[model samples]
Target: MAIVVNLDVMMAKRKMSLNELSEKVDITLANLSILKTGKARAVRFSTLEAICKVLECQPGDILEYVAD
Candidate 1:
Protein backbone atom coordinates (compact mmCIF):
# COMPACT_ATOMS: atom_id res chain seq x y z
CA MET A 1 0.00 0.00 0.00
CA ALA A 2 1.41 3.35 -1.00
CA ILE A 3 -0.66 5.05 1.63
CA VAL A 4 0.71 4.08 5.01
CA VAL A 5 -1.15 4.52 8.23
CA ASN A 6 1.11 5.74 11.04
CA LEU A 7 -1.49 5.59 13.75
CA ASP A 8 0.58 3.44 16.08
CA VAL A 9 3.48 5.84 15.91
CA MET A 10 1.32 8.81 16.79
CA MET A 11 -0.34 6.89 19.61
CA ALA A 12 3.04 5.91 21.02
CA LYS A 13 4.30 9.47 20.67
CA ARG A 14 1.24 10.74 22.50
CA LYS A 15 1.49 7.97 25.11
CA MET A 16 -2.06 6.89 24.43
CA SER A 17 -3.48 3.38 24.45
CA LEU A 18 -5.73 1.97 21.78
CA ASN A 19 -8.49 1.75 24.35
CA GLU A 20 -8.03 5.40 25.24
CA LEU A 21 -8.02 6.55 21.63
CA SER A 22 -11.02 4.46 20.79
CA GLU A 23 -12.92 6.04 23.66
CA LYS A 24 -11.80 9.53 22.71
CA VAL A 25 -12.60 9.04 19.05
CA ASP A 26 -15.77 7.13 19.79
CA ILE A 27 -14.73 4.37 17.47
CA THR A 28 -14.63 0.62 17.87
CA LEU A 29 -11.42 -1.01 19.07
CA ALA A 30 -11.43 -3.51 16.20
CA ASN A 31 -11.73 -0.74 13.61
CA LEU A 32 -9.02 1.33 15.24
CA SER A 33 -6.85 -1.75 15.36
CA ILE A 34 -7.39 -2.30 11.67
CA LEU A 35 -6.27 1.28 11.01
CA LYS A 36 -3.34 1.03 13.38
CA THR A 37 -2.23 -2.19 11.76
CA GLY A 38 -2.60 -0.74 8.27
CA LYS A 39 -5.34 -3.17 7.36
CA ALA A 40 -8.02 -0.60 6.85
CA ARG A 41 -8.82 -0.03 3.18
CA ALA A 42 -10.52 3.28 3.78
CA VAL A 43 -11.10 5.87 6.46
CA ARG A 44 -13.79 8.54 6.53
CA PHE A 45 -12.66 12.12 6.80
CA SER A 46 -14.87 12.61 9.84
CA THR A 47 -13.26 9.69 11.58
CA LEU A 48 -9.82 10.90 10.64
CA GLU A 49 -10.67 14.37 11.88
CA ALA A 50 -11.86 12.98 15.18
CA ILE A 51 -8.68 10.97 15.60
CA CYS A 52 -6.51 13.99 14.80
CA LYS A 53 -8.47 16.10 17.20
CA VAL A 54 -7.90 13.62 19.98
CA LEU A 55 -4.26 13.03 19.13
CA GLU A 56 -3.42 16.72 18.71
CA CYS A 57 -1.97 16.12 15.26
CA GLN A 58 -2.66 16.77 11.64
CA PRO A 59 -3.59 14.15 9.08
CA GLY A 60 -0.02 14.06 7.84
CA ASP A 61 1.09 12.76 11.25
CA ILE A 62 -1.06 9.68 10.83
CA LEU A 63 -1.10 9.11 7.08
CA GLU A 64 1.83 9.04 4.76
CA TYR A 65 2.22 8.58 1.03
CA VAL A 66 5.10 6.54 -0.32
CA ALA A 67 5.79 6.01 -3.96
CA ASP A 68 5.90 2.42 -5.09
Candidate 2:
Protein backbone atom coordinates (compact mmCIF):
# COMPACT_ATOMS: atom_id res chain seq x y z
CA MET A 1 0.00 0.00 0.00
CA ALA A 2 1.23 3.47 -0.88
CA ILE A 3 -0.43 4.89 2.18
CA VAL A 4 1.22 3.67 5.34
CA VAL A 5 -0.22 3.95 8.81
CA ASN A 6 2.28 4.94 11.49
CA LEU A 7 -0.13 4.28 14.32
CA ASP A 8 2.18 1.90 16.10
CA VAL A 9 4.93 4.47 16.22
CA MET A 10 2.65 7.11 17.61
CA MET A 11 1.23 4.66 20.14
CA ALA A 12 4.69 3.77 21.35
CA LYS A 13 5.65 7.41 21.64
CA ARG A 14 2.52 8.20 23.56
CA LYS A 15 2.89 5.06 25.68
CA MET A 16 -0.75 4.27 25.14
CA SER A 17 -2.34 0.89 24.80
CA LEU A 18 -4.70 0.09 21.92
CA ASN A 19 -7.57 -0.56 24.30
CA GLU A 20 -6.95 2.70 26.14
CA LEU A 21 -6.78 4.67 22.91
CA SER A 22 -9.96 3.05 21.64
CA GLU A 23 -11.79 4.04 24.81
CA LYS A 24 -10.49 7.59 24.69
CA VAL A 25 -11.22 7.96 21.00
CA ASP A 26 -14.65 6.43 21.29
CA ILE A 27 -13.75 3.85 18.66
CA THR A 28 -13.96 0.09 18.76
CA LEU A 29 -10.85 -1.89 19.66
CA ALA A 30 -11.30 -4.16 16.63
CA ASN A 31 -11.41 -1.25 14.20
CA LEU A 32 -8.54 0.59 15.92
CA SER A 33 -6.56 -2.63 15.87
CA ILE A 34 -6.99 -2.81 12.12
CA LEU A 35 -5.66 0.73 11.84
CA LYS A 36 -2.78 -0.01 14.18
CA THR A 37 -1.80 -2.98 12.07
CA GLY A 38 -2.03 -0.95 8.84
CA LYS A 39 -4.83 -3.12 7.50
CA ALA A 40 -7.41 -0.42 7.00
CA ARG A 41 -8.38 0.43 3.45
CA ALA A 42 -9.73 3.86 4.38
CA VAL A 43 -10.26 6.12 7.34
CA ARG A 44 -13.02 8.68 7.67
CA PHE A 45 -12.08 12.26 8.48
CA SER A 46 -14.21 12.17 11.61
CA THR A 47 -12.49 9.07 12.84
CA LEU A 48 -9.14 10.56 12.00
CA GLU A 49 -10.05 13.66 13.94
CA ALA A 50 -10.98 11.57 16.93
CA ILE A 51 -7.70 9.70 16.81
CA CYS A 52 -5.65 12.85 16.44
CA LYS A 53 -7.53 14.49 19.24
CA VAL A 54 -7.02 11.57 21.56
CA LEU A 55 -3.44 10.97 20.62
CA GLU A 56 -2.45 14.64 20.53
CA CYS A 57 -0.93 14.22 17.11
CA GLN A 58 -1.35 15.40 13.56
CA PRO A 59 -2.70 13.23 10.76
CA GLY A 60 0.73 13.28 9.16
CA ASP A 61 2.08 11.63 12.29
CA ILE A 62 -0.13 8.61 11.70
CA LEU A 63 -0.22 8.51 7.91
CA GLU A 64 2.42 8.65 5.23
CA TYR A 65 2.36 8.48 1.44
CA VAL A 66 5.03 6.61 -0.42
CA ALA A 67 5.28 6.40 -4.17
CA ASP A 68 5.17 2.93 -5.62
**TM-score top scorer:** 1
What TM-score should be assigned to candidate 1?
0.97
Model 1 local distance difference test score: 0.97
The parts of candidate 2 lying over 4 Å away from their true place are: none
lDDT of 1 by residue, 1-68 (tens): 89999999999999999999999999999999999999999999999999999999999999999999
Task: Give me the runs in candidate 1 sitting further than 4 Å from their true place.
Answer: none
**How displaced is residue 23 in candidate 2, in Å?**
0.3
The residue pairs found clashing in candidate 2 are none
Q: How close is every model to the real structure, measured as TM-score?
A: 0.97, 0.95
Report clash pairs, candidate 1: none
User: Residue by residue across 6-63, what tens digits does model 2's lDDT show?
Assistant: 9989999999999899999999999999998889988999999999998899999999
